[model samples]
Target: MPLPLHLLAVAVFAMGTSEFMLAGLLPDIASDLGVTVGTASSLTSAFAIGMIVGAPLAAALSRHWPRRSSLFGCVVTFAAAHVVGACTTSFPVLFAARVVAALANAGFLAVALTVAATLVAPDKKGRALAVLLAGTTLATVAGVPGGSLLGTLLSWRATFWAVAALCLPAALGILRGIPSGRTEEQAAGGPALRTELAQLARPGLLHVMLLGTLVNAATFAGFTFLAPVVTDVAGLSDTWIPVCLVLFGAGAFAGVTVAGRLADRHPGRVLAVGGPAALVGWCALAALAHEPVALLTLVCVQGALSFALGGTLITRVLYEASAAPVMAGSYATAALNTGAATGPLLAAATLTTGAGKLGPLWTSGALLAIALLVSLAAVRGRARRRQPLPPSEVGTPGAR
Candidate 1:
């Protein structure tokens, strides 16, 4: 029986909301906990660190378990962590809960990707991944805003309670929809741990992982400071910032939708196009910081291209690490989280150095340009290594 991919997407939505809602709740949390804003912000850092460390650790620990069982356990743990966070009044306890929740989130996502891949045909793996990731896109579009609204209307702790409640339904869906037995690929057995680690060390695989990190870092460098950019540089009032965020989220949803249709057929081409598009968008944003309309347009484009590039990059990693998809997925998760952590620091440093509000945009553009060059080199390398295509693939654009 095929697993219900939508259920996995729902589970991802639950996790994404928990991961992102923290940003909106930080100030309130600090006020309630009687801590400095800086200390409250460390909760976000703790969650990122947990994700970075948990991916490989979870993969290794759950390597022998059935995918369905692993996912169920992770999701349940995630829900429990959120409950602890919601109920706790102590800052340290809530912070610890966030870390535990993040660990469970990483574990669930890694296993979910593996299970999604197994459910689909080999040629449609990219589409499956895109579908699974759409949950995160939807979270940005709907869940984050909803959580923010909930926090604003009630207390931040109430928002945590809401997210924890949502996780129960997601867990039930996973239990009902996922198969009880191991996937065929798992049953057939994959490469040994030694072989999987060796594959991770390959130059091509390493380059793809590096590209993933750079792509995410570039996106976040500017996005993490969007509130200030909109207010100070673009000359928009605070009221319009939420509108801009919605636009960015909409673009991200569109990007993932397009990627779902095209990625399996033209993964390389998608990367080629998306990488340069993001670079151009970031450059335009830096130069047009004073133009409100231009800033809004460029932000939307940047969001779309960044997410489109991300989907294709994941597909590339899966292809390159075909023998160990689960481990490769874990590595990709860790790399992206690494970028997520690094981007904000870089953006903050630029601000402290007295670079104007446009510093983050320019910084993002520079990083994106380098990632684009690496992607182009990778494409050329792949082409050089290929033999003449069969009659079937000769006419296919993706074959190139």
Candidate 2:
């Protein structure tokens, strides 16, 4: 709705395209680098690891910096990493590049959440965040597919080069368009990192983190092995891989849009509905892997349910924390990264144990069940806290 929002959107679009392209281009990259596909896949893993380690580290390190400047710094770092990745011939060098880019991407996203939240009214926070998040969704629906096609037609390295080029204009747009508002100045001193840590000591917040962990694990369980499942297990062709991913993306886009709107209206209901749907989808995905049409149908359902919960859950965590918005954003993102890292590792372990296509889906279903329980617990905990409050006070709310 605002110019700053558009700037943030553009930045997110470019960054998301850069990050997801690696997955689509993994085959080309691995072949070129003379490495195994699993080895090449580690670049994605490394990036997530970096984000888990980077969110708080960047937030703490840049405690006093202006939010706009911090965003700028992140883009600069991202651009540099992309440049390295594009030019480097060695797999190790490219892996390092991805790690650097991931750290910067996490920092930028953390700051952007705070910045976007400040730009809109309290009532519009979920919608505003939805707009910001749309960039990433669109990348999945559009950018990743395009980059993959380009990589298939040309070179994987070219995709990285294109992303690097995008960052230059994105940085310039941030400098010229996005307002360096005064909120950053006021927000700088709200709470020390230690105070934020103490607040996370609250059981509610801790459970939220655990919920994030489980939900993400559930997502990765099916997703990490999606390519192989669709190809080898389902007997689909490799040429159709992007098509399947785009189908998932279409589902993700719809899910995110619905979640954002519903969160703006009734986040609690969305949360309530999400878990059961996700659990069902996970089970369905596992069961339908051998049936081509059923597999695609189930994959779309699973993708929609899994990602739709993202905004709702993140917004819930931010509101519950209510300590420091920026800090909360950082912490929430870290929790997400933690789950991301865990999910793939768990899936890998299952695959190693001869579970094949079924392992990830079963593991994900279990994790979703766990997340569902935690979410119900959170709802119950909130209800218990609100029991003593006045009706007028109890109905009021905030979105991170």
Candidate 3:
């Protein structure tokens, strides 16, 4: 990856740690705030909700700002939110901080995607995005677990403070690495804001975005409950949760690396294989939830399958939304975050119904099944659109 892309990835790493680290900290948060763990989980929902609402709004609001300034401002806000989170005693304040941090994260991602594409050759945009997203994978492997350890060794507030501190250098990296001007996407964004908004509503782009959303929903539905599932269903020790997380993260890193290499050239091939495989992986997860050996293995397998499929679908979003490059990142961010919000909330509801850990696994499998069907439909639609008409139908009135 280029230095600029690497810097953006580093910034993403800083941001993603806060996003994923909450899963590990939820128990401590519940303990500290005198709330049930279930209630504390709302913090996870709050952040996703922020990203859901923020992606498009931030993209539109910052559309006219210099790319570097927009990115720098977002990171700075993200840092400030963490500072507030660390200092707050009230659950409501902490919850509000999660939303603020997520808004910043969403804005940075929205701008980062456009900037990343501009930093690389047109043909390499997929890889560029993969590299940027790889930051999240790295965060999963390192930062998430690192935060968990920090929360364990010191305090949950320590995790917040650490994330706040990390953002300082990340803000500087944005100012140093990202170019200071109207980006290429901004230049292509016609004077009318409606032009960019129209892309979100475009059926083809929406289809791809929907596919991305479903895959992510399936992935997160299982992931959000990992700590509990490892301990309760698999009968593993709390110490095992971080190890499981590392395995899943390792798998995610590998999945995204392969997607970066193949998605641009073989998007259909990847969709054909990845969708069904991800669905099957979820099925295995549900079936093996009680078997520690099998459950742990499935975690890694599902992670790889989910991210590979999800990453490709997102790459398709960029391809489909190419006409509105400035808004493409917003579309992707909104898609992923929508799933992030929906999946865990649904899983949490299932848990409240006394479905046990199997509920989340089933929830994940069901979402993946829907994703598979959507993927198949999308691939078929793309194929039909690309297929040539017969000679007799060529230039015919009916064909037209």
Highest TM-score model number: 3
Summarize candidate 2's per-residue lDDT along 182-287 as a digit string, tens digits.
4653555667778776777888678767787778667755665677777778898776667777777778778878887887679868768888988988888788
Error of 2 at 62 (Å): 2.6
List of clashing residue pairs for candidate 1 = none
User: Which 10-residue window in model 2 sums to the lowest lDDT?
Assistant: 179-188
**Candidates in descending lDDT order:** 3, 1, 2
Q: How accurate is candidate 1 locally (lDDT)?
A: 0.79
Per-model TM-score on C-alpha atoms: 0.87, 0.89, 0.93
1-400 in candidate 3: lDDT tens per residue?
7898999999999988998887777778999999987778788879988998888888888878998899999999999999999999999999999999999999999888877877878788789989998998888888888888788789999999999999988888888988888875567655466877777678888888888888888888888888888888889887787778877888888899899888888987888888888888888888887898888888888878888887887788888887777778888989988888888887777887667767877899899888777767767888899999989899989896
lDDT of 3 at 66: 94
Query: Model 1 — which ten-residue stretch has the worst lDDT?
Result: 238-247
How do the candidates rank by TM-score, highest first?
3, 2, 1
- True-structure lDDT of candidate 3: 0.85
Question: How many Å off is the CA of 258 in candidate 1?
Answer: 1.0
* Residue 97, model 1: Cα distance from true site in angstroms: 2.7
